[model samples]
Target: MKAAALLFIICVHLVSGGSHSLQYFYTGVTRGINFPEFTDVGLVDGEQFVYYDSNTRRYVPKVDWIKNNIEPEYWTRVTQIAQGHEANFKANVGIAMQRFNQSGGIHTFQSMYGCEWDDETGATDGYEQYGYDGADFISLDLKSTSYVAPVPQAVITKQKKDGVAAEFMKNYLTQICVDWLKKYVQYGKSSLERKVPPQVSLLQTDPSSPVVCHATGFYPDKVMISWQKDGQDLHEDVDVGETLSNHDGTFQKRAELKVTPVERKKNQFTCLVEHKSGDPIHMILTEEKIRTNSAGNNLPVIIAGLVVAALVLIAVVVMVVKRRSGIHTAHDET
Candidate 1:
């Protein structure tokens, strides 16, 4: 029992001594002072001692383990690097915003980490800032900020605004041109023989006088005027005028056709404007003097009218027959 008591006291002494060693080293290292070896050489002041294990690549904490683990210099370096990167990122975003605002293009600014100020509306915005924990790092606030600016002065002051708008407009015009060139020019060239198609106006007009056809829309230069009669293409009977481009870059086309009075009365003529895209659109004109033939064209309506007339006639005949029979029966009873 005495031996066991002696052993227990020794164990307690060793534990206490080990704890004291760790505490002294943790305190000194955190104060930027050198750590001392765990050996019993009386605590030396101002002497740098390496307490790191070279084989294990681990440092022994001389101060509180949590407090001394992160060096102040390490955090300082990290802060400096982050600030520099943030500056560059903000500068690029600012330049892009300035360009888009001046040119009337769409561009919006958003904060990935810090607060952003809207120069237009004077609003402040904040986004999530990223941070590093002891073991891992993560990004916050993944959403885009909501400050949009008008086109900047730099974009407007440059002579290229018209050119840029034109370039943007070109996409729409190019599509039209490609379709037109394919249908009219390409298809025309592929035909066995080139012929100037006639222009017929289907709208009501006097055959003895010239009928005027006007064109209006975005593309004026790409329009062709022609006339057709009884589904056959005509050439000499139609006169097409030059297409004129307007100040807004749109076009206007006109054509005139003179037909015989008999042709107008027959309602056999149609006016066709062939677009560059090979899509032919038309307008029909009829003369007021022409009597419309409803004979075979209104078969269902004629049948319905005949059926109603027959039903009314049958009702009248039945009423007369019943009246006569009632008189004969009454005379027989008297």
Candidate 2:
């Protein structure tokens, strides 16, 4: 019974068409921000937020914030904060730039407090004012300068770019979904997971004319194709083609479409390929030439053959007439 069950499971996997090799899809916003600098504060304060995935041992953006915001503007600001922290620390290191740049390991300092001008007494007083309380404050005359190791600027720059890019992508994707929902009015949530690649091809009758549009993928349970002209859905003068299976293990699918050259040239035609997953892939074919021609089409070849035969016959007739008229003998003798 156990063996039979194992065999059944294997059969089920084969029949069901197991998942495609796992490929990570990373989409997000990346932004760059200027770091702050400060002088004379004497106290160095630096902070960095390192993101990591405990389960996958990979670094990925925090997803919760992204879904909730659904806007690029918000994520752009978050990236600024993360980058600002790194820049602030670099300024604190001051003269330690060389050492920090060389190796960014931990560096410690002992006597960091220094004797400087008092806020109340000004530069005349040697005592350093330590507190904001009315008159009660501690005073230390001994002055020493210390540098806290700076944050690695390279690291900061990379993080800032990545964060911003990830956020931007997220927002872009969300907007796509919103637009699709507004237009379709029937697709349910969770439709974004089944996205397939877009299709571009030549129209059937006119091989020289190219048709660019989106079609449903191979294995998707449901799919839709739409064309837009001047930002409006085009219903007339557009022919929707059939979908074909890839027969591959994955869910890849394709569909054909036909549109007139006028529509294609106007840039008014867009092929929107949508699956249950998310935003559809939009494709525009600008070129008029078709991508493929049927091998059986023989009109051009037949015309060329007829022209060659006519030229050969004309040459033969001229040669015979010259020979019969004795012109061939005269020409040869000369």
Candidate 3:
């Protein structure tokens, strides 16, 4: 049972699809002077999957994406893996708890099984440790037989010479999880290539302002936005800005190029954006194309002022004409 649980822990780490499938197996056994002693097993599937909290005795999932989109068979296999570890892990913890009580030590026994792998770099590493309190008493590395000190070189050398480490890795880690990973990749294809086409715009704070090429709402993170002079890419007077996140999950970034008042009259600057999903987006920067900061404000303000002035002028002319007519009527009557 120990061997099986250890192999499953290694297999979970070995599974990668453009990202690591980091899973942690945990067990804890605690007993107070008067309280009852109990042990439980836990399994945590990172980020996209579920976590079995031994304390709660329930499986809590991070997202429902797997259940909604993933095939039933795939999830069933994952459930089996979790169930198989439950009893074995509890039994292992019970043994540790018995040992601690026999020694008359008041301590908690905890063990963690972890797998760390880097998908881009193709690095696979994991460790299993059992200890009381916070210090580990037993440690094993699945990668190699180079055991640390206090674990004698003779023992490690003997294990290495016997090829124990190599056999364990091959038989358990490599072969067990191949079928599951194949289906996981298919179900997670959208996550691997999820992208939003960039929305590009050429803008200026004012008519004579520096031209900025902006791109927003893109995914998979990295993008290139640049200022082009005539047909070539401009390097001088270019301020390449950093990409920033939007309120939504996408990202936004802009690159600015200083444009003089004289340069604004010419149709020489163009903004170019490159992203994975679509063809390069291009926008020619011209005086007419540059959007001023107060472009929409000026027209409404001017129109309102003219209407108010016309109303005041009309009122004054009517008052003066009425006064003249009253004077002429009084003169005629006299």
Candidate-wise lDDT, in order:
0.30, 0.28, 0.45
How close is each model in CA RMSD to the real structure? 45.3, 35.4, 29.8
- State the weakest 10-residue window (summed lDDT) of model 3: 314-323
Report the Cα lDDT for candidate 2: 0.28
Candidate 2 lDDT by residue in tens digits, 55-128: 23223233232234345553344344323322332332332334235334222111111112212332211111
lDDT of 3 by residue, 1-334 (tens): 1211111121222232354433343433344433122222222222224444344444444444446775566445544444444444445444544544555444433344434444477564544444434344344445553332222312332343234433443233333332333344455556634767997766666665667777767764567888888889889999986554343435567788887877756647888898877888888876566555577534333223333322111100000001111001000000
Q: What is the TM-score of candidate 3? A: 0.38
Instruction: Tell me the lDDT of model 3 at 142.
Output: 52
- Candidate 1, residues 219-258: lDDT per residue as tens digits? 3134567777777767766787544323322344556667
- Strongest candidate by lDDT: 3
TM-score of each: 0.25, 0.25, 0.38
| Winning candidate number (TM-score) | 3
Which wins on TM-score, candidate 2 or candidate 3? 3
Question: Pairing residues by index, what is the TM-score of model 2?
Answer: 0.25
